[model samples]
Target: MNAETASPILAPPLITFDRVSRHFGGAQGVTALDDVSLSIRRGEMVAIVGASGSGKSTLMNILGCLDRPSGGRLLIDGQDVSALDTDALAALRNRRFGFVFQRYNLLHGLSAAENVEMPAIYAGRPAEERRRAAHRLLGRLGLQDRAGHRPSELSGGQQQRVSIARALVNDADIILADEPTGALDEAAGAEVLALLDALHAEGRTIIIVTHDPTVAAHAGRRIRIRDGRVVADEGDDRRGSPATAEAAPCRPGRSGPVRLLGDVASAGRMAFRSLAINPLRTLLTLLGVVIGVASVIAMLAIGDGGREATLRRIAEMGTNLITVRAGAPGIRSLADLTSLTIGDIEALSEIRGLAAISPERNLRTTLRVGNRDYTTMAQGVWPDLLVARSRQLAAGSFFTRDDIRSYAAVMVLGQSVADILFPGQDPIGRQVLAGRVPFEVIGVLAPRGVSGGGTDQDDVVLIPLSSGFMRLLGRSHVSSVTLKVADAGDMERVADEIDRILFDRHHIRNYQIRSSTAAQIIMSDSQRSFALLLGAVAAISLVVGGIGVMNIMLVGVTERTREIGIRMATGARRRDVLIQFNVEAIAVCGLGGVIGVGLGLGSAVWLRRLGFDVLITPMPAVMAFSCAFLTGLVFGWLPARKAAGMDPVRALAAG
Candidate 1:
């Protein structure tokens, strides 16, 4: 070599190993490097050669900062690296050393250009800058045309070229090659060695670890390791080992807000790319979250719809109304059915704040018009039934109070009864026999639909109380009394006054009074509880989906072990790996959440079309989506932690 070439080789040592020993398992376990001491100067090409299990690869790993020494100090650029943390070592590898692996170690899902940009991403380079740099490096390596191709699409030689471009992307000063030509054919291997030679020619330190003598012959110096120790050192007798210098201070690079945002963007892109590779698996993973969110949304909407419909129906039944029934806690006798009388109705009329009052005398009786006879409920009520129960007339007029006083047999038919008894015809002025007692239909009540208790409120016949009692089966007692309050605020006080009057008359609490407002509150509370219960059950499904996410992520981490090692070797910190894996999980769930919301809305619409009450609100959709996101976060933790805590050397050794 010329004097100018020899001068750079004789400078201060760039890497020094002082009694370094690396033991796997424990101190008594297998030792990969035993009390080894060596030094390499700047701008030199060195080769470490050994057979299988001879510790050459271990030595290369320790030298490249991918693995740590167990018992001794390693110094780079005259500074001891033994005390440095993992992130500090990562920064050291990023700023100073680049690695080229035998199998190329190119991420399968990333494009050639994207693979080459990996190191610069960890270095926090701008996206456009990294793209330009990656393209430049690929072009220099003669693979620029294949920049958009994935690793699987490239030949072995082209992939190796991409790997070399990746190594050089960070502008590192030292190149560490471990069996770089092992997987390539002879011609491809020669081309790769030639690339290494060209790199060495540019004043960069190069270290090659291989078992092949032909590959080691390209280096100027050769060192042979065997049985965890250096057995031979040849071809560099002129250069002497340099002393270790003082340990220098190092601070790992801290990512700023912009850099963090950039990292998130990069992670998001990578997550989508990874998911795109195996679409079936991604879809399967998303199925659980989608179903869970859809169930939650649909169920809550159904509950809300049912509640609103019921409340509306109750409001339609007069919210300021009260009904008094003639049954108490212990009154099960037949005479209890006859306990309420017209005198009680007259006594209740004496109370103030009463808007309207009606006495009901109901009996299960058969009505016959011509040869057609239908068994139905016969209700004997006063004139105030229309006002008290909020009933409206569809045709004709209601029975007058004089009709009740004179024992005139006139009756009003409910809508359903009118339809059944007098089909498609006006029942006004028509005579219907109530058990041989003829009665004229004076009016037909409008449809009231089904009550909350599942009873048809319009399936009844109304007659004058006095006529029904005196002329129809001689019944003198009333079944129930319906009362409408003038003011809703006076409902409780009015109920109390009625109770006192009934108690003074009957001398017992034999009557039960129910107010519409109280019923509304009770029904609302029950509905709310029902809705909450449905949500809780649906939330269980979401949790189960989250568990599915956790399981799939664990498998994904296993499958991407080597990729994790590659990123770490290229300067990615543990937090970066964690963020990458975690974001991938969240992306899966987020997409599922969107699809699930659409599905839920469609389901609700279908249910509504099928005659079910379904109410859809934005808040439920938002809540369901938010729950899906949180599920991903909670369940992704374990897999992300497992990936971040991986040992890079072991991970790289993984298939």
Candidate 2:
């Protein structure tokens, strides 16, 4: 009797159930609650007691907005909740009722303080404000020193205290506790019941659902439910006057840009906390993204470096130089081989854009000096040959125009030929035999590396065109006419002019025209194709990494089903849960991307040290990072949606 029976209930019922019914497995399946009708007044301490499978828990769940009835209307403060959406239900739960579970349902990863601050977080309270409130709640609950400890570090009673603190974080008026002291010892249970008494003294409605008769005895009003029906109502009529509950209205969080940013920040923090729980699993998930991004950046760098090397080689051959070879377009018959003559070179020289022109006759022969013999290519040209081919003299001067006019037996030896024939001695003024013809070496050409065809370019000798034609070949026609255009932009025009002049002179098309400009174009196309091929290969790895992310997130959703239920129970909306999981996935990929970029640049430098050309640029790193982020966003969606779409009651019931 005492103080419990003395306190009168003043209410136009705060919660009402007008014949609510809940069923599982369709209408003919398990009937958890059937035609349940009840009304609880404001500031009343009511205990709903029943045995197992008696629908007491179902009634409590419906009262707390954690589950919806299949039939009939449930009202809160005279407002029907049957028409409310999931978000509206969640807001009502967060602002009106505070739940304390039998098992204490505290997230094992979060500290006590963090667990207490959860409701305030969903309430959209600022960080500083939530922190202070959480600490104050923990101190009042006698767990201030254990605020930083995780659930596993706390005893069962301490954890329950922390759960109570979390329930009261948002200052909810109606405390719906399901078996609050069922998992506690006798002393702890007494302490909890005393706390409930204190809350009831402050004019808050308290509803307890339990199977223990001793626990039900603490409430002023006892309602017994058997087989989903209220069998007996024992205790005095506490409803004295028809007075409405005047609890403070709850704010539905915030809105606009500021709220969105806060939600994002909170999601990020939660993501980190959850990921940190299993460090090895998080690391394994990150591995795939890291490898994919690193491979992309490194492959692109190598491709770009190779292209640069190729283009430089083409430039070395000369971009503006054109070659007019004496042959038909495809077939080079004996008659077509003699189509280019000295007249063609002279006519091409008269073209407006011609910088220098040289007529060349080539023959592969053995050059011998003092019994030392070497097989090499011998080319006959004028003094302008050096300028046309961009050749430089290493020691001596090139053959003069007088040597061409006089048909002098003088030649310039390429660096490779000079090294083989002259050995350690100077080649200038030395006599060398080319196909039994003695020739004086006037100069030695500087070294030119291997050509694109993988053959040495410095293994040749140059002689006067007149000497090669009259003394060696005994012919007037030259092997080829080489021209150096004044400007690269004028190459096409000058080639056309040369074609016209040559057609007028020979009266037939018997020569093939080629240019280094065409070679440059071919090289460019080849480089692009090679780069794309490399990129495509690397992109496959990125796809694999994305799949890995999807698989991990799916497994994560399954493993954290209970956590999701806990969040939902605390008033988190579906979108909030979605954003939380999505932010976790993105954070994983972003961290991996940063590490991958560093690894890729380091790998590029390592390749360079190993004598492999690698061009490292910022664009590839940025692109790889962006791709990683996109991979996370694309792959994380399905799992986040799955988590968000879960039924909170089923999720909470999941093991």
Candidate 3:
């Protein structure tokens, strides 16, 4: 039996459309396909010919399952195609049909072989098998030498051939070619048509849509569609019928190679490659996110550290310790003899829940030890003052209770004051003169670095309170009262007790009693406020970074318009286009986020080295990363939607 005689009898129609029509727009409607009905059989070569606006491309879309008929029964391989939803249509297209567009829709960053593997990738083929199949298809298409070349590096003809190879990679039953030779020269066009013919001979169904009569002449049957209707259906004598061609040496079915965990790995690899291709833009877009993350982390770390240090210092002072300083009475000085007396401290000490109370007075005077004389602030208090203030003695011993009772001239010098007065000599047991009175130095205080308020507590002198009040100042007044309570939880009650005691003893009313816990709380609240302020400033940068991402993604959509059009024309669903572009944007922003995190941590380390007490703990790092990724998603969504919703025909025309 000759190849030309047996085609129609052996071939089974794979596609059938019964009175299908598609319309666009709302209210004022435009009909894209009007009552179109057609049938395409397996193992047959058919062409659809029409001028622009004749609905040939629309019919091709319906045939490829890219778009559905508005009001008709469409069937593919005896299955009701029009009844399937969008996702089902996409799955059917992936499993049963392949598409080849005039403008090759290869990813710009990928090599030719990678582009050919895309359909199989969408079909969820394993990596190794997909790669092997892609290589085979490329080799078969006479593009083995150009397999590693990017789309930009290939000629228009070569790109089209790669697209053809991709269409066949899935081994789909139907191949829909929409002006497959439109972008090629005569020589390349003839070569592509020959490839299609060879595939048709292998018992594969092929449909070509074109306006060129010469292109349609190669098919065994040609269907002329005009105004959304089939104007002519004619069988050509030049090309033999499909049935006899199917009996000839058929090409062996190619099975894709199986790979373990292929989908995630392949998508990640593609994402990485795409990012590597545009380094500068990715870096700039991530700058804001990085700055925001780093700033928030650093600020919080510093604030927390400072708060912890302050609280530790306060705890060391004594868990339930409280201080009462005599403020100026209207216009009177704190040192005025008419204000506080020793009776006030004795009264406060006798209150319930009170542990101890010490009266204190401060004097600004010059200290002289041997030949060295320096000016320093002196705090006058009893022997119990050291215990309430949590002072640590570095050398010698603190003043005894006997010294306070006998009014002995004794003093404790802070580290800095000791260094200044004694120089290289030991200050313990040495006599130091404060203004006119002389006192024996009993101890040298330990070094306590800078406090939260930047005050150097190691630059003062301590003396017996009675000696400072009676002998030096020649008065019985006290500057402040220090008290320790039995329980921290009873701080408010104890404070009230002390206030009542002082008010009763001095015959005064409306006096305030402050606790150390309140001070600590105030300090912490202030620090938290500062941290929030810093975070707000940093958030502005993140917003700017998000804007940068949105702008770049919009630009990317514009730049890849033709690529998007080609993908859509090749049976990619609207959601698929949306996801692909969104993934690309996410990939770019994610790369930026990774780089920013590294930089932020590095900056924290650098600041710590500069003595700024910075800590980039795990929580802050995690928060930073989360912020970066979220920014990408929030900013990249609109542009991705724009790219996905673009009209394929108009997008292709844009180029």
- Candidate 2 lDDT, tens digit per residue, 1-655? 2344443645578889999998989856998888988888777789999999999988998899999998999998899997799988988888888888999999998999999988888888888888998999999989999999999999888998898888888888889889999999999998898888787776778899998899999888998999888998888436323332577456456778887789889999999988899999899889999999999999999998888888777766765889988877896534227898777787778889788888888778888888788988888788887788777889888888888889899988889888888779987998888888999988888888789898888988888989988767677888787889989999899889888898998889888888888878889899979988888887889779878988998999999999999899998889888889899889988988899899888898999899886888899999999999998888888899999999988888876
Q: Report the C-alpha lDDT of model 3 over 99-151, residue by residue, as the tens digit.
A: 87887667788899988877666666666788999899999888899999999
- TM accuracy, model 2: 0.89
RMSD of each: 4.4, 3.6, 4.3
Model 1, TM vs. native: 0.86
What lDDT, from 0 to 1, does candidate 2 have? 0.86
> Runs in model 1 with CA error above 4 Å?
1-9, 236-254, 306-321, 327-343, 346-356, 363-378, 382-412, 421-444, 451-454, 463-477, 484-493, 506-530
Order of candidate numbers by TM-score, starting with the best = 2, 3, 1
Local distance difference test, candidate 1: 0.86
Model 1 C-alpha lDDT per residue in residues 55-149, reported as the tens digit of each score: 99899999999999998999998789988998898878887888999999999999999999999888888888889989999999999899999
- Give the TM-score of each candidate: 0.86, 0.89, 0.87
lDDT of 1 at 171: 78
Measured with C-alpha atoms, the lDDT of residue 272 in candidate 2 is 91
Query: lDDT per model, in order?
Result: 0.86, 0.86, 0.75
Where model 2 places Cα greater than 4 Å from the true spot, the runs are 1-9, 236-244, 249-254, 329-337, 352-356, 364-375, 382-447, 461-476, 484-496, 515-519
Q: What CA RMSD would candidate 2 show?
A: 3.6
